[model samples]
Target: MPDGCCSHCSDFGLVCTYVQPQRKRGPKNITIEELSKENASLKAENTSLKVKLLSLSLCSLCSRPLQSLSAQANSSSVFHRSTPESATTPPSPESPEEPPDEQDFTGDDLAERFGSFSIDSLKTKHFGSASTFALANNTLAMKENFLGRPLLIQSRRPLYWDVLPWEKEASNQGSDHVLKFPATDLIAALLDLYFTNVHPTIPILHRPSFERSVAEDLHWRDVEFGALVLSVLAIASRYSHDPRVFLDGEGSLSAGWKFAKQVLTIRQLSEPTIHKVQMYLLLTLYALGTSVPQLSWLFLGVGIRCLQQHGEFRRKPGAHKPAPEEEVWKRAFWSYVVLDRTNCVFLGRPMGLQVEDYDVDFPLEVDDEYWDWGFTQPLGKPSHMSYLVLHVRLCEILGGAMRRLYSSKKAKILMGWDGPEWEQHAVAELDSAMNDYVDSIPPHLRWDPQNLPQGTFFDQSAILHITYNHILIVIHRPYIQKNERPKGPVAFHLCTGGTRHHSHREYVVL
Candidate 1:
């Protein structure tokens, strides 16, 4: 046994074994050399591990405070992500000096830099120093004077259908003519899509009347109804996700041939009718769904004008009892009401048609087939009409919130000290109203995991729940922005529940 072998083995508690002796070297020397090599490798590994630990410990400023990061990102201002090309380059003289530590950059610094600029200017003017803080690499790069607000990268929209080469190419020799009108099969598919998917939720048109128009080929016979039919197809196109028919869901104006025709016709409509009103409503919904809220708001105004022209707001003078046509008009009027109030809440505008000015009761909860005649009784519990009634009730709640929280005058009033109290009370009332609305829903309409029904009927219940959650988020979002409503799960629940479970089902049947 070697003298130092025991020392090495005793320290590490590793047993030293016998080895073949070299010419002049014994087990002691061999063991010492082996121990030295093992110690060197271990030391290198420890040093490497320490380097890794240090690198892992370092986090970017933007990565830690996600709530604050999201708040800053969601602003309508522009933010710049540092490309790999930009990151490796030497700092330019134009770039502002970055703070040594994340702590050195205070919220006050953000305010001082941004406080003077108007939102319009902020949105329009390109800020030089809007370098994006990326969480992926935990990297920070300073830009010029302004700190960049985080923003989603927007995709380029397609060119308008008029500008596309479809017409020009068709005009050239040896090319097939671009479609001037929708094909029979395409129209059939679109109409089927609308009736099966879109109509169940909204149910604005009388199905019997619409089918009669379809049977007569009213789309070609009546220009106005033709325009309205095109709008219905446009809205239905959104649900199709069919590449040939709907080229882009985001830019509907530039996508489908039928949608473009609808827009052109609506723009040139010299005389407006109830059909025109219906067309505008469907167009507004398509616009809103396709990320063109301003256009939706504009269409809302046009639809309201047509409705008012037809005396949709007041009951007819000679009729003691409601006629079938009268009932359709009432349903149409309330559809406008639902849309206008919801749009106003989103756009921060005053309600165009106040509830106080109207006196029509909700349309009877019967299927559209019964609108003109036959079977006044509902067929099933979760029928289309039940969804309509629930939607109307939701609209009523939405209108109340709009009047209290989102009206331009109300918004102005909310900027004062009394705003907090008003906000709290209003939010509470809305929350209470939403709960009651959900409670008021028939047991069949309420969602149940154990008793999930098959088909689009499930969609009504899902829509109710999703819309309720969405409304809850909208109502409490201001409070959430103010750091109140910490317990509110509306946003998270919507992302998880609304999108994951129901959003696919909402349009799948259509």
Candidate 2:
């Protein structure tokens, strides 16, 4: 029996038998050679068990069952397990190696690559919402703080000198005719000069005398001058660090606004001519509204009065041939509408007009001969002046509605407005208007060089005839707000030269 037990113990090994004592125990003292042999055999058995457990652990499909094996191996003193499957899997293949030499990631590359990255990836990882991403990344990068500013949908053709009728003449005349005291340049120069002389931070352009000369004699009737003023005001409002330039206290802007009001009051402006002036006035008021709310209110009041007075005049008996005063008043009314509409919606105020009330009568009729000029021909004798006024008023109302929707108390404090909803609504309305305007202007009108004026409009009738179509285009384009993004050199040219010029005059806000 002892001989049989001793043989069984030898086969099983002393360590295994010691753990299960009823099976049998090994010899208490043994030769060193025998002990070393036993240790070697135990180590070899432990290593084999460890390898099997590791293989099971690495197989995700079998990992849960492998836990039991791991416990068994641990009991047998085998803890070192191999993860050969995981190690050999090779990091999920490393995204299929990009071409080593390809580098330039242009917009097209970003569109293609990021476009495929999955919106879920963007929302969960990169950007939050589409609107938030667009606002922070694209709009902020373009330096547009105004929420109402339009985004360029696609790359556009550059504004070239050849696009304008006067470009050839201006180029041939060199700097003398092109740059010399043109009414538009003059007003821009004056504003630059005024800002430079008064404000320490603002830089003065090189030709101070030339600029002053242009401003002093600037033709208020010139449509290009109007465009120039709008552009300058838009930029100045956006970039100017000094709020005092436009604010009431001691700045030249207050005086400038007063002066503009005087000019409008003194001059008996024709309809077409006043359209240009009104456009500038509206844009200037918008810029001023950013810094001075009260001043803007004052301007708003003036605009309302102008509209009311004009409405009364139109109602007066037998005013058949639209008097020049009537035209000026009509222009002022529309100017007010545009300015108020923009401010009311953007600044979170109640809308002042209704959509139904937009229809009003005008003395002038649409010339079917100029239908090719790119403006929407009214179905009837649709009052061009009245249409503009009503359009602006409706925009204001929509802006107010939007402001009510997204507005919060915290946002109001930050923006110095009643709510943010109005701004959002206004932005949507403006964007819509821009689209409508772009659509309204026919493709043929864009290429019509003869449609532009020769010089200044000395005769009111000629000016009215020449500018009637273009005024509609200007109102629709709102170029300053529309073409704002810097899209290379070409965008710069269109942005600077796209609109007709107007005289430097104070715009009354009411």
Give the per-residue lDDT digits (tens) of candidate 2, residues 179-290. Answer: 1122354345546644443211111111232244345544233323433343334334333444433446655434334223322333222212222333344434544634
Listed in order, each prediction's TM-score against the native is 0.56, 0.26
Compared with the true structure, all predictions reach lDDT values of 0.59, 0.36
Q: Model 1: which ten-residue window has the lowest total lDDT?
A: 120-129
